[model samples]
Target chain A: MIQVENLTKKFGNVAAVDGVSFNVENREIVGFLGPNGAGKTTTMRVLTSYLAPTSGRAAVAGFDVVRNSLEARKRIGYLPESVPFYPEMRVREYLSFRAKLKAVPRKQRKQRLDEVMERCRVKDVEHKIIGHLSKGYRQRLGLAEAIIHNPPILILDEPTIGLDPAQIRQTRELIKELGQDKTVILSTHILPEVEMLCNRVIIIHQGKIAIMDTLNNLVKDQKIKLEITGNINDITETLKQLPGIKNISFTQQDLWYVVTIELSNNEDIRDIVYQKIVQNQWGIREFKTERTTLEEMFIRITTRE
Target chain B: MRNIWVLTKKELAIYFYSPLAYVIITAFLLLSGYFFYQFVAGIADATALRYVLEFIGFISLIISPMITMRLLAEEKKSGTLELLMTAPITETQVVVSKYISSLLFFIALIMPTVAYVILLIFWGKPDLGAIICGYLGLICLAGVFLSIGLFVSSFTSNQIVAVIITFVILLIGWVIGWAGEFFREQWWKDIFKYIGFFEHFDAFRKGLIDSRDFLYCFSLIIFFLFLTVRIVESRRWK
Candidate 1:
């Protein structure tokens, strides 16, 4: 579990992470969404005990990240954004070193390294020097390093970046499997990755939590659009009077009226709209209800500023 | 404690694995050995090994900083420092582990110089006291340079800058004594000489075990290492 309270970190005069707080429950995969320089990495640094909060507190597994940093760090598996490594080291060698630093018992270090290597799909490059590996393998090796000690919490910063489509899918599947038993706080630019892997989304902008909720609740009420060709003025009036119609916008193209309707409280106005169109003797051309994807919602929330 | 050991092991591996370290080591061994052989070939000066050690001390003055320039700088450069710090270890452990590893590598480079002492024992009646004091002085002097080197490396990602700054700081300590030459006042001269590392090292070359010299080396080590911890901790705050 991870708890952040009023966490603020400053660089010189600028507050990189300003008054941010969030809680992650056990075994929950929380997507940390933010644009570039949005303080996502700064917050992750604070949570991992790499950076001390300038004016607030962060805890992992009930240990204070600053006061009890060593204990706090023991529970966190952090993969920083750069995914840096000692290029001279072999994949297996680096993982084993991390295993030791993470305090994996000496007896189990080899097994842990092997398991993480396999989980990250980097077993083939175990003995190969890390410098010689491709970007995808190096990124996977960073994952392998993070999970080597099998920490309960995983704080991954852009884990799937620079990977091929197939590699991305494999990493996503691996993270999904990891989230089954561990709390994962994944910060990434990929909207689909977050949509597929994260159950809860925390959209951050300018160092503040802009939107935080389940993936479903982010775009809660789905809207419907109906295009009618006959007696569009009457149809507009009828649609405006509908109980759940929160918004109705019309665009005219020649003889047809394109009605875009936004409903509130999960209202399904389609059947009633269809009935109205039939009852009023209005001809319906295109009637459609679409599910808004996370990309659309992401752009809406992040750009709202 | 074990974390320090683990980190030190990895650092030492890097030292041996990298070609630059080997290059530095070979240069160190060749230069120290050549000067040492010359000191022996010159004649039985009785203080031959001490002169060789003093000369090696000067060499270490130049090379020790290079050995530790990348200790923390490379980690910061590559961003692996985040991996190290976010592990279950304190900043103190990180600094100490790196200092110990660089100190060990310096000692390994000095290991061949021990053969010089063995040669002295075989070829001449060397004063064992001066020999032991010379080694003690070299190790302690190394502690001083390595600590400063480690401190400089902590806050910078540029290895060249780390090396240059470390050399500048150590060279200041080395040359601070020369400025005393211009002073007619014994107090000012004594002050400059006292701060310079050469004065304390000279005492050991004469087979003297002065606690003052030990304190100088120790305080310098503690002082730089302390500054390193503060710099490392300030990264989060900065």
Candidate 2:
């Protein structure tokens, strides 16, 4: 439901988003993966008709963001970063104002407000002024505002940043449910959030596309760490001599040794390592394959210029 | 049109909810009332309404910036400008709604002055034509000045700076006609006269409805509103 081609937004001499291209299909929950200042918010702003692209094109729901911005915006429910809100207005009043601004029909306005308030779990504080609400409540109110219009597309920039773990999980579930038949593009600093909700991920770094791939493909390379308790020098030398093991390093604690081996390919060397330990009569303390974390992938991909 | 109304209602709600609006309204009413009473006690004529209106016109140059400084500046500072711009509305639409609401709030501040008109009608024979024309002149002058104020407010997120700069701009525009008297060329004097506000507003305050003054204020309103739209749009790039 959203298409961006070579989008570059420049501020003075610095390009906030440079030659970024990506497409999000209908009913897909795509994660805009990036570190802070990776131009994720800038790109989302262009898509939501909040900023004009300096070059290239972006369209939402088949409407060009610049030429037909009103129509493009009509289809988008945007929750911006930091969630700016009127502190004086009540929760329900703010949501109702948004519903009207988004052109929800007068007849259905109350119903729409009610649905979003409940979906976002902001019903209890519906009568409270926004300044009195906590950060989590304010964040939920921002979510409620975005969904109040029931638009076909939702562009949320870091929706769960300041929430408690339970609130974050609840919001994640809500977003997962919302993406069932609508286009949802959410940006976040949390990596596991993507693993849980996003089918596809677009990782950006320093105003450029770092990698765009499925989460399954992104986390395919996993590493294993082996710990040996007898003759630390002998175990370290033996593991380094094994095949298909590239980065073999030894760390010693008292008489125990932790041998970390990075598998160069998909070979399962646990059997070979175990056999070698038995042949040498070294005590095997622990053996486990470590999960390939997004941090590792992010560093390798973003730093590999 | 409905969108404009919706946005305008939001602006008005913001004004009423804040104590700043109350302070401005009360101060305006009290000062204008005191000025009106002084005009009646000193001049003792129907033209007292016109004098009070002229005083309002001058005072609005000071009061209007306070009314309009936070209109767009606060939105920018708080990042609500993104919300408004990303809504299903044009930048021009945002400008228009803000203009209308500021105008409405200006009317609300000036509405109580109608009691002065009522009192005039009750105690003495007031010239109905001049009262209407004088009030018309005040509204027109407000349209011209408030548009400039709105434009200045859009320039920065600092409300105090917006107020100070707008006050300076209006003050300069009001007094620029004085420099025209020193000019040897008729064209230079005419140009300055055209730029100065008091010349256009003087006839209106004296019960004369000159089309030139009306057109000038109307043109100014349109020009500054257009400039505001351009400045707001340019922010996306810079």
Candidate 3:
């Protein structure tokens, strides 16, 4: 339940978030994928009303971020990239204070606090001073604070950053669980995390939305790889002549030829290439169609910078 | 109002949990007590209540910055300002809470000095009117210093820089009255004397509740608090 229309944030001469527009539907888990300084955090901050956009409008739950910031903030939970906390406060105390700041009713605060602590798996360290906890525990405490009010919208910037593998897995599972009923906009540089957790992905590069689509659609529409061991030069030219073939390159390793073909669109050109190979009487060691991974797509998009 | 109280409570809790608050109060109390004892013994007078009040005013010159140097600076350094600002609380709530908590701690530290007032009651009859006025003056002075310190703290993330800048500003405001005496022009002298902090405080110490003096201190406090809020708001852009 978030809408950003041409949102832009500028720091003097540099545009941190430039003319970016996107919508996150209710109960949808959308991943904001980008490299460092790709304006992901800036965009998230604008949506959360932490930083005022130099131009354009953003709204959460039908409230304009600038005009109705307090009401909008009341309906959304934000976990910044650093997840700053008062180190001296105990985990439960911090979460309770955050609950009060979020304007949870006095009567419901304790129950909401306990529920979020349990959901975030931070109940055990509830009494421990947040400063004394390890990084993973501190991150969980941050998450606990964000969800204490049970806000419908969650804007988490790099939610799984700096966690160990097990902690990452745990957090990923928790995010998936939370996404069941909450609208989550997760910004991170981790491509696989998006593929594993988000239903839709928005890849941002150089402060612009490069690609935004479902994982299945993004992979199905981009480049495809075919490994064929045959007359390398002849088959490469023939594959290039195929209707859907956009670009083809071949690298030889030992006795086999690995050919990577970029397609103009998602189409079945495998049979046509196979017939061409047979007509040319090329030696075929292996022939299989390969779809582009999200990682490959991300690298292609970001590296274009 | 609820948000303000919550933030105020959290700020005070932070002061108590950290060792810095204890260290600041202890150092201030010991130094002021030593100055009070010496000023009493040196003057060869039993009534040192006014002298004690003046000494406290000077002690606030140091203690005020110590209490407020880290107010917004540390929040910015630690990145916690993002958490506070992104919450439902408004910027005014944040500024007012921090200012109120600083004043509360300042009052708490000065509360123990009531023993001195009790001692005066036992040893000699200090003018009750002047004693009340003296305390009023100290509180107002602390308010002014705290506002300036909070403003300075909001300008930088460096606590040391905040402290130094606050101290310099307070020192200048404290001593600027002397500049009028150095000048030969009577109009310039009068203007400097009227603008100085000590001039406004002198009326309060004399058992005179002048509205102009009260308005001056109140305006200074409000002005600095407003600047602190504006500076904090501008940081989000940076």
Most accurate candidate by TM-score: 1
Model 2, which residues run further than 4 Å from truth? A224-287, A303-305, B184-188
Local error of candidate 2 at residue B97 (angstroms) = 0.6
- lDDT tens readout by residue for model 1, B51-145: 88889899999998899999999998888888888888888999999999999999998998889888888888999998899899999999999
Looking at candidate 3 chain A, the ten consecutive residues that score lowest on lDDT are A221-230
Model 3: how far is A276 from its true place, Å? 15
In the range A43-155, model 3's lDDT, one tens digit per residue, is 98888778999998999999998999999999888999998988999998999899889888999988988888888888999999998998998888888888888899999
Pairs of residues clashing in candidate 2 = none
Q: Best-fitting candidate, measured by DockQ?
A: 1
Give native contacts recovered, as a fraction, per prediction. Answer: 0.91, 0.68, 0.81
Docking band of candidate 2: medium
* Predicted candidate 1 versus true structure: per-residue lDDT over A1-305, tens digit per residue: 88999988889889888899889999999999988999999999999988888998988999998888888888998889999999999888888888888889989877777788888989998999999999999999988888888889999999999999999999999999999999999999999898899999998888888888999787567778777787766777888898887788889998888888888867666788888888888877898887777788778877884
What are the per-candidate TM-scores when only chain A is compared? Answer: 0.92, 0.84, 0.84
lDDT order, best first, reads 2, 1, 3
RMSD of each: 2.2, 3.3, 3.5
Per residue, candidate 3 scores C-alpha lDDT tens digits across B63-181 of 89989999999999999999999998889999999999999999999998888778767877778888899899989989999999999999899999999999999999999988999
Worst 10 residues of 1 chain A by lDDT: A218-227
